[model samples]
Target chain A: MEVVIGTIAGILTSVSMIPQLIKVLKEKEVENLSWMMIAVLLTGVSLWVVYGIMREEWPIIISNAFSVMVNITLLIAYFLYKEK
Target chain B: MEVVIGTIAGILTSVSMIPQLIKVLKEKEVENLSWMMIAVLLTGVSLWVVYGIMREEWPIIISNAFSVMVNITLLIAYFLYKEK
Candidate 1:
């Protein structure tokens, strides 16, 4: 039960950016989204991946690595769509 | 070094939403922000807190609890500032 719960939580946090990505893709709007948030998140999750690697924890590595990718994509979209 | 990296990673992910919250408050703009993303993240982090409690991990508990509070505040701000 604990593992299940942890996995669900991990999955949720990892993919939490999907909705925002969809909104951005559909609306092509990024004015209200903060690149700083994504930048910070990308840094955090990337470190998480490194920590996971150090600890030999696959779940942490996989989940946070996924978050890194999602945040990076979001960051790029923010740059692409934000008003100049 | 591992603990140091992990702590910084935890801190970063925990406070990742602050910039977005600041942006929303300053601009009072949420048109491009997805409540779905925040909602999903809130649920995820809340579950993380639960997982931490079950596992008896203070770091996870404190970090995710902070995330929950920040997310709840952001949710309220989103509702307050969003145009109908």
Candidate 2:
């Protein structure tokens, strides 16, 4: 039951960003993307990692750590393709 | 310690979305926003709520539920502003 719930949570978190990812990819634009937004999200994700560590919640830690990578990649792409 | 951690977590989660929210608000555009993305995020938050309930984690439950409201508001705005 724990595994199932954790899996569901992970899926939900990972899949949630598909729209923004698709949009940025398709348009090759991120004029609307904000550095602060990305920073805050990264910070939040990092804190989640810390929270998981403090609590020893493997599910939260693993999923959020993975999410950090994905979000970082997106942010990098945002910077790379941003209108100059 | 738990309260502090939970409060930090809640703030992190809530503040994390500020960038997207600001961009959407300032641009008055959500052409890139995806319903699927919002749905997934909402689902994630909802699942988090359930997880909190199961675990009796008030912090997670309250924060996620609040996040659901904020995310729903954003999605509603996205739909409202989307080109018809």
True contacts kept of each: 0.84, 0.54
Candidate 2 lDDT, B1-84, residue by residue in tens: 755764675587666766677788788887655678777888888888888888888877788888788788877878877855
Each model's DockQ? 0.88, 0.56
Worst-scoring 10-residue span by lDDT in model 2 chain B: B1-10
All candidates' TM-scores?
A: 0.96, 0.83
TM-score of 2: 0.83
Docking category for candidate 2? medium
User: Candidate 2 on A1-81: residue-level lDDT in tens?
Assistant: 755775797679756766777777788877756667667767777777888888998877887787788678778878878
| Candidate 1: tens digits of C-alpha lDDT, residues B1-84 | 899999999999999999999999899989989999999999999999999999999999999999999999999999998855
Best by lDDT: 1
Model 2 pairs whose backbones collide = none
